[model samples]
Target: MFASDRLELAERYTELLATEGVVRGLIGPREAPRLWERHVLNSAVLAEAIPDGVSVCDIGTGAGLPGLVLAIARPDLSVTLVEPLLRRTTFLDEVVAELGLAHVTVVRGRAEDLHGKATFDVVTSRAVAPLERLLGWSMPLVAPTGATIAMKGQSIHEEITQARRFLSTWRCGEPEVLVVGADVVDPPTTLVRVPWADPKRIGWPLARDAKRRSGRRDRSSVKREVS
Candidate 1:
């Protein structure tokens, strides 16, 4: 939930999502009416799972779903919105400026593009990819003690089963499934949090690939860093 002081900002963001968000094809026209309930509030609840004053990176954050929402709700968190599309990043940059969210940073690039270059206390995503693929892109950006917290649907149990091999190969701890915003939202939000099995012994199965990719100069141009 948003604090009283931050409620107005949240409202403004909702309006933008209904207007510019829809016009740019980021949000569906049908979704405009239920933006608050289905999107904003659902995303806001994710704050409950995060710790205070942590650095967060939300990958594939098209139109900044949970990422921008988190920044509005928790001013203490330094949020980085990572998206691959320029159009989406444009809208995100505008929203950050309009809301005067100084702690937010907008990066136009894929999550994999940040591997070996940056890491955050918390890496987040919403319907970006499946569990197995998500682990490949997210784990590289998760700090030794940090975790990847993604919003998932009811098929989470099945997805976890399919990703069992990946969890073990990457030395990830048991995935913790949590339901947040039960009192506020009807069905509530389902989140899957995956952390390293041992902070002292983090695994980087793709570190070599990340380093090779990071060496490419072209990749740098694709990632736009806007504060």
Candidate 2:
């Protein structure tokens, strides 16, 4: 559940997505009826995997799927919605302004183009590209010791197998597939979590203390949810 303010913003966002988002060709018209279940809630459930008070970058964020949803669900996070297209970013900007989400930022740029410019504690993407290619573009933006969380559908296991070589090359650990919001959302939400190698061993900067603090929050929240 969300607070009163976030719930109101979520409603407004859903309305915008069903109407303006459809008109602008961002979301298909037929998807309006299932917008809450298939799109908004599906994305929002990803917050279960994200830690509190950490930076998150959502790459290829079309219409701010998981990005905007995450910002709404977890106000503790610093969320960046990155999209390359002007039209998509325009829509995102308007939604962020209307929601008055001070913790969210909209950036217009491709993930590949943003290498070395910025990095995040977590990089997320949904319906973006194949897992192999997605890793190529997203992994570079993940802070050393950070993780890339990709929202994948049923074929995720196969994609992980295909991406094994890339994972090895990048020194990433084995991917973990998690199902979140099991009771809240039908079919739940599937996430492929890939953690980068230790920074010192890989010649990158050391991990930040902020991640540890957020990790503690993550554990506490999960405990409460399970109980």
Candidate 3:
């Protein structure tokens, strides 16, 4: 937290991962250091896209990347990090407390189970799942005119291309991509937004799995997200 630049902050994030032994427990020892570049920096890129005063919900916020990082970077917005794992959820709660972050809430539950009571200005998550599923679980939480920013790597273009079917069917708006942190993040990234959709979309990423099993849902199934 005391680090000045992204370079140092990334180092600090790595140091904390090792010190906290979170690397060993959550992502395994081999992958922890890489998290500095892969996760933290990747998540931080969303900071620039965030609008002021927006209350955001980050689904599957394992280590509170986009959500926690966004909250730290933008004090004007409120961030809610949703993670079901108890230990991870506690870790986020503790980190927020330690950082003295004034605007963060770590919720423990599967994304599909939590109904945000229709109270978020923005919804954000990183590779939490396929676009179709992620939208289903996330779109409902978005404010009527609110947006969902789905973070994906450079190959996101492929998913974005394929996701149009769902976007159009759901009546969700256009998609967007951003290439910030070009040097620090791999495959670069994109921030996709679905402007307005059915008020309560449930069973998103979760449904993707089920759809696969029955083959009942596919590119065409993307439409039914409303109410």
- Please write out the lDDT profile of model 1 over residues 1-227, one tens digit for every residue: 88999999999999999999999999999999999999999999999999998878899999998999999999998788888888999999899999999878788878877887666778999998999999899998887778899999999999999999999988898999999999988789999999989876677844323322211132233244322
Candidate of highest TM-score: 1
lDDT string for model 2 (2-119, tens) is 5787888888999999999999999998999999989998999999999878988899999999999999989898787778788898999899898888777777777766564556
| Model 3 spans with C-alpha error above 4 angstroms | 1-14, 21-24, 183-187, 197-227
Q: What is the C-alpha local distance difference test score of each model?
A: 0.86, 0.81, 0.65
* Least well predicted 10-residue stretch by lDDT in candidate 3: 211-220
Residue 55 miss distance in model 1 (angstroms): 0.5
Q: Please give each candidate's TM-score.
A: 0.91, 0.88, 0.75
Give the higher-TM-score candidate: 1 or 2. 1
Where is the poorest 10-residue window by lDDT in model 1? 207-216
Ranking of candidates on lDDT, top first? 1, 2, 3
Q: Candidate 3, residues 64-183: lDDT per residue as tens digits? A: 767877776666776777787888877776777876765666677766655433336788998798787888788766666577887876567777678888877666766776666666
Candidate 2 deviates by what RMSD?
A: 7.9
* Index of the highest-lDDT prediction: 1
- The TM-score-based order of candidates, best leading, equals 1, 2, 3
